[model samples]
Target chain A: MRRLGAALWFAVHTAGQNFRRNLGVSLAGVFTMGLILFLVGGALLFTHSVDSVLQAQQAKASRIKIYLSDSASLASIMDFQLRLKNDPRVISVTFENKDQAAREAAQNPDIQAALNALGSNPLPASLNLNVRQLTDLGQFDSMARNTPIVDKTTATDYNPDVIGKLRTVISVISLVGGIIALILLVISLVIIMNTIRTAVYARRTEIEIMKLVGATDWFVRWPFILEGVIGGLLAAVFSGGIVFLGYKLFVQAAQRSLLSVPFDASYSAALLFLLVLGGVAVGAFGSYLGVRRFLSV
Target chain B: MSVALAERPIMSPAPALRPVISFHGVTKVYPNGTTALRDVNLAVHQGDFCFLVGASGAGKSTLVRLLIREETASTGRIFIDGHEITRMPHRKLPKLRRKFGIVFQDYKLLNTRTVAQNVAFALQVTRPGQRHLREKVEEVLWIVGLEDKLDKYPDELSGGEQQRVAIARALVHRPRIFLADEPTGNLDPDTSWGIVQLLLQINHRGTTVLMATHNREVVDLVRRRVIAIEDGRVIRDEAQGSYLREGEATI
Candidate 1:
């Protein structure tokens, strides 16, 4: 037990000492690691925000309005809405009577003028639907056209071109974000490994002497590994703080504009936690590999 | 510190039956096809003081390296304390190495550490939680005649003092065998003699000592056991020999 304590103390003490002695290289490693972590965290948060915004836009686009024939009875329209609502692909169904449609049209001056010129409630009652998937909108639109109560002159207002474009944009953004994150992670690992290798190289004489004096491999490795862990923790804390503050500012800036980007506190917290864990893991593994080559002596 | 070599304690002439270090047909052929040693055979008993006199690249360092398991012999076997270490597993190298204390030509002291810390480092790494670490360091420093220079760093000391610090670190653990590879190669004759006196003193305390050197003067003056290596082979083994054999050409 005492031996363990003494060994722990030596490792901790040596780690601190080495960190200070090689402050230039040490801080450089930490700085690079911090920058990479910040980039990763920032990219993740940005991707998530864009995804949510696209989701909201998708929800708005995944809707159809079926115009009912003027002669259709209220009971039949309500029955049609209930049937649409029961469909697994539909999120919601709402009935808009002619009066409600006219009222909504009145908010548009051109539509109100056209309605005044007609001198009758020309606006038809409509069934508005919110579907689960944008791709299913075409199915819903075709189904609406076959309904007997649906108006034949103008079918459901489902624009395939707009929905397809929106879907494409969402997929492209997700793909680009995923690729960027993967590339950044790979770069971070390589950079950390090289940086730790440099630090290990600087103290190779110390390692050689230790080995010559009969120190066990782990005994020599502990201090360097501990140094890596400490460096990793420091980088994570600094980068996590910057990422959190940057995400808040980004959300606020986006909100101030036309975009409605939400500040997902839980997701940010989770991402920060992952970043810290990644930093520590990379740091430790890098040091382990760096010291490995010198231990053979 | 200047010390008289002639005033050293008398050494025991009796040889232990079992050799603490022995080599049976040991050969080392490096990857680059440099045959460093060939069919070398020798035994160093306990409390023996032997000189390994050879020219540069004459396999002196290879012998030292093989004993510490820093390099494996390409063939044959080696035993330390009657245990064969040529084929010993990597995990057991540390324990095997603990049986020997080694020094190099460059002193190899940690320049950033104080004399005391440099000596204490061996114990800290090999025997953690060792009580009286300070006293132990002091005792070793005293043995190397550096008791008052505990707090001094290597850079602050002279070359001789620096070598003493290295000696103290090696002796701190009280290894059973001491291996010095060109320990006095970088020192003057006077300082080299002082260092040899220290090694002789260490051997007097019953630890086997093997010094690989190119100093013909020290080897001739000491007149102890001499193993001369020429062209990767031990050409001569004398119980009480000089740097060169009787009426022989250059070594």
Candidate 2:
């Protein structure tokens, strides 16, 4: 335990010393990591907001109306309404009687003129269904058509072509964003590895001397690994701040423009945490690999 | 067909007198197909000061490297203090290496660190406690006559001073054996003499000192046991020997 403590102290001290001594190189590494992380964070925020907007638009167009036949009884209509309400896909079901339908049509100027010309109530009672999912619309429509009392079923303002195009766009955006994020991650890893390699190369003699003095491989390697982790941590804090402020500003702008963006506090917190954790993991792993060749002596 | 040095008791009747280092038919061949050492057999007893004299590429450095476990032998076994180190595990190599302190021609001192820190580094790795670490560093620096220059970096010191710091680092660990690979190769005759005198003093204190060098004048002047190597073979092993073969012309 004592030896471990001493090793930890040495690693921490040396890591700090290395960072301070090579301030310019350290800053360059941090900046590179920050830039990569910022791009990745931006992509995440973009996809999340796009998904939220798609969901809001889908909700607006998910409503379907089932017209009741003239021979349909009130009790049967109520029973059908209860059955639809019990279905998980149905968000809400409202029953509109002939009187209510006629009243609503009279409120509309064009419908009122048509009703006045006809001189009779031509509007039929209908059951309005707001489905939770856009994909459930077809099943709900078929079920309503098969019902004995349902005259015909019509979905309100739902366009299959538009939804399909939007889905394709979302998938394409997610795939491209994910690929770009992965590339940035790989590039950042290589850069961190090279930075660590250079640091190890510069201190090659010190490493040799340490080996000659009977220092274990861990004794020599831990400092470089710690240095990498420190560099990554600095980058994380820097990039996290930038991403937080940028995302906040973006969400505010989206709000002002009447755009529905999904900006949850918990999600933002998780993203920040992942960025910091990823930075540390990449830095440590890179340093470990970089110093492996030098430790063969 | 070689006899083990551990079995031979001709050098001393005292039971405490043991071989500090032994090589029995040891051979080293690099992966690039260069044979550095060929069936070499040697032994150096505890408290013995031995000089390895040879030309460049005579396998002197290879032997030093093998002893330090930097390079493993292609065949045969080596023992240090009755322990076979030829097949020692990689994890155990560090513990074995702590038994010997090694110096190089380039001094290998960290230029970024002060003389005191350089010396203290050895102890800090092997033994880590601030109070004893400071005392040992001061003592070793004092022995190398660099106590006053403790805070000076390698660049701030002369070549001789730098070598002295290296020696101080090597000695700070209080190793049982001191291995010097051309300790004075980069120094002037006067500075070389000073470093040699320090090694002699270290040997006088009962540390088995094995130095690989091409300094003929120092070897001839010191008149110590010289093991001369030629083409990866020991051509001569004589106490109070000269640098070259008998009656050989000085190049």
Candidate 3:
């Protein structure tokens, strides 16, 4: 019972002293921990933003846009829309008459001038289709071409190149964020371990004194462990606070600038939990390792 | 000040209680084949203040180490409270260690802690309840007469003060017996007696004290139970005074 009481008091007392005594080191530890967590949180937010943005822009259109041959009749357009809608991947298809084409173009200044010069709705009618998901873009484009619309059907002006480039960039950023976070976490642990070791070295004389006074091995060791835990916890709290502020601001900026893209900036609870858990884990583990290594029998 | 043990014209011998600590033909050989102690037999009875006088390597340290359960003996059975300690496992060592307070010549007070912290550390480490730990620390510091210096760190105190803190730490737990290994080796003659006086005072309260030292004047002047050791064997054991419960040394 006495030993256990000693353990608890010593744990608290040592951790407090360690935090105070090693302020510079402790701050450095906190900074590293917070930065690592921030990186992780930031990457997750960005990925979420990307997914939300894609989700909001609307479902992918059927990979094929059908342009009727000049001689193709209205019956054939109706037949094509019906046939494509029944296909497994197809969601919906709409037929636009030549008059609708001329009307849409007349809204564009350059295209309207060209239409007025023609002085009539001479453009062929077309079909606009939407698909359920973007699965096999190449296969989708091929299926659209084979829709037998009795004319040439092709991909529209949606720019697949841009989407592809954005996806690639997101993947790289996520991969880089993951690597950096891992490296920083390892570095934080090392710094904490080293700090605890230094404290042990400083207290070696005190330990020898305890031994002479008939203080047991356990009695001598517990205070140092307590010190480590204290150091770790302080670092954690500091880092956690910084991460909370940073991500909040980041989410705010995202919401403001990317109004068209929907982003949830309300995951404050999860972020706080991550910070606290990280701090406690680092402190406890750091203390355990320091005592284990430095206080070896 | 608490009653200064008046100068005694003659001291009385303590009644012989059961030997608090007994070593039976104890022999200890080091891992390097250095025979530190060989066939040493000794006993320390309760309320008897005794000193083990020997040269540096006369197994004084090893024997003291054995007494505190710091190191075990090689070839002999030892007993504290009649319990065999020869093959005692380490997990049971703390309970045995708590039975006695061990002081050293260097006055091993924890320098990082204040005087109160050092004294309190003993009870605190033993896991006593908070109230008892505080009360006991205050009581022991009062006994050592350092209640005013509780906040002073070990480095801020004199050698005598540091030793007093160490003594307070040893005594705070109120062990059944006291052990000192050259407790006065680092102090001057005057400071040495002051510490000895404290030991004598504590012995008066019925706790057996076994101090190992080579200080001839302390041995002759105090005239308590003096046991001389040389070459791992007991040369003398004599009781010179009656134990007083809480008064000046009539012994």
Candidate 4:
């Protein structure tokens, strides 16, 4: 217990000394670290926002359309629908007969007169098939081709090509976000190291004296480590605060006023998680890198 | 190694009431292949005002380092209060050294802090309370006759005044052992005597004082136990009470 108290006391004293003695350098370190984390956090925000669109596209991907053939029998279409239902790729299928199709078409006054001119309903009976997942569209379509009664199958609900394109776009965004985060974290680390090195250089003589007085490696390193921690803490607060405020503005402006459909879900929780994590990560990484470079113990 | 230890000599007929330090053939071979101490065998009893005098590279500083656990012995062992100091680990060194107060030649004052702050740094690093630090610092500053200059920076002080501040810092913790390595090496003659007199006064209060100096004049003025070294060997260990007078001792 006494040893623990001594250690804590020493650590506190070291931090106090670092704050009082190296205030300017510590502040500079904090600002630069905050800027780096901000850039990283900004990139993350951009990727997350853009990827939501792609995620929704992927979530609602597969529904099928049946082509109308005037000559096709209702019995054959019913058999095909039953076959589709048995297939594991299909969730459910509904048959639309020519009569039903004609009645639905009658609701549109523009198409009604044209339909009335025909001796008999020219539209053929068709079936609608919906699948479990957008990614399963290929399998569902391939299975539809094997069904003997199905003449042709088309997807009316989800576009696979559009989803593919969106996936590629979001993938690129994610990759770019990761690279940018890595680069900015490196920058934060470099800034921390330089600041600590400056502090060490300025106090080289004092450190030497401490060494002469039998100060251990831990003792010598405490002030430098404390300086790094102080810088990191300040940077954490700044980055976290900015991220929070920016998130609030984006939510209030983007969700309620400007673009509503994409951001209907609550992003405040995600924003809170991101801000706190970015702050802590930036603070920890900066301190780790700074101390690793400048201190021995 | 034992043969060399037997061949070299620092051992003496020490009176054994209580020994503050004892070296049983301690040697220091630095990383760059320089041998600083070669089988040093010495004992410093409690309350002895010992002076280690030597020319440059005569192992005086290295001997001081071993006593304080700054550098461990390469070949042999040392004891402080009958405990092995040569094998002490780095973690134990600080607390062990907290028992000793050191006066360095360069005055080693923290330039960023005031005189009071620098004096308090020793106790503060040991993590005494704020009130105790202030009280101890004020008392030491007064002891060194610099109570009024507490707020002055090291750069603002003259050479003699800076040395006094360093002395105050060293003494503030009330260490049982006081080691001063060339403490008067930088001061003028009159200032050197002032420091020597202060050290003697400190010794009178029962702290074991070991000073390493090249200044023959200062050594003669304030008579004490003088140990002279030549080429990594102890040549003379003398009591300085009746051998010399104040004016006759010159650099």
In terms of lDDT, which candidate is strongest? 1
**What is candidate 3's lDDT per residue for B1-251, written digit by digit as tens?**
46554322112234344467887778888899888887887777778888777677877888888887667888877778767776777666667777888788888676667888888877666544556667788889888888899899989988988888888989987899898889999999999999999999999999989888887678778877766666777665656521221253432
User: Proportion of native contacts found in each model?
Assistant: 0.81, 0.60, 0.33, 0.25
Model 3 misplacement above 4 A:
A1-108, A118-133, A153-166, A203-234, A244-263, A293-297, B1-50, B57-59, B71-79, B82-93, B110-114, B130-135, B145-156, B220-251
Compared with the real two-chain complex, what DockQ does model 1 have? 0.67
Candidate 4 or 2, higher lDDT: 2
| Tens-digit lDDT track of model 1 for B53-169 | 988999999999999999999998888887888889998999998998999999988889899999999999999999999999998998899988999999999888898888888
- List the global CA lDDT of all models: 0.90, 0.87, 0.70, 0.73
Model 1: per-residue Cα lDDT over A1-297, one tens digit each: 999999999999999999999999999999999998889888888889988998888888888999999989888888888888889988998888899999998999998999999999988889899899988988888888899999999978877888788788878988888889889888988898899899999888899988998889999999999999999999999999999999889988998996999889899889989998999998999899888999987
| Clash pairs for candidate 4 | none
Model 4 error, position B95 (Å)? 1.2
Question: Rank by DockQ, descending?
Answer: 1, 2, 4, 3
Better of 3 and 4 by lDDT: 4
By summed lDDT, the worst window of 10 consecutive residues in model 4 chain A runs over A288-297
Backbone clash pairs for candidate 1 read none
- Tens-place lDDT per residue, model 4, B1-251, is 65765445434444456477887767789999998877777878889999898888999998987787767789877877656766676577777777788888888898888999898777666544445568888989998889999999999998889999998988887888899999989889988989988888889899899999988777766677888777777666777732233344545
Per-prediction TM-score = 0.95, 0.94, 0.74, 0.80
What digit string (tens of lDDT, one per residue) describes model 2 on residues B41-98? 9989988899999999999999999998999999988888877888899889889999
DockQ of each: 0.67, 0.62, 0.23, 0.28
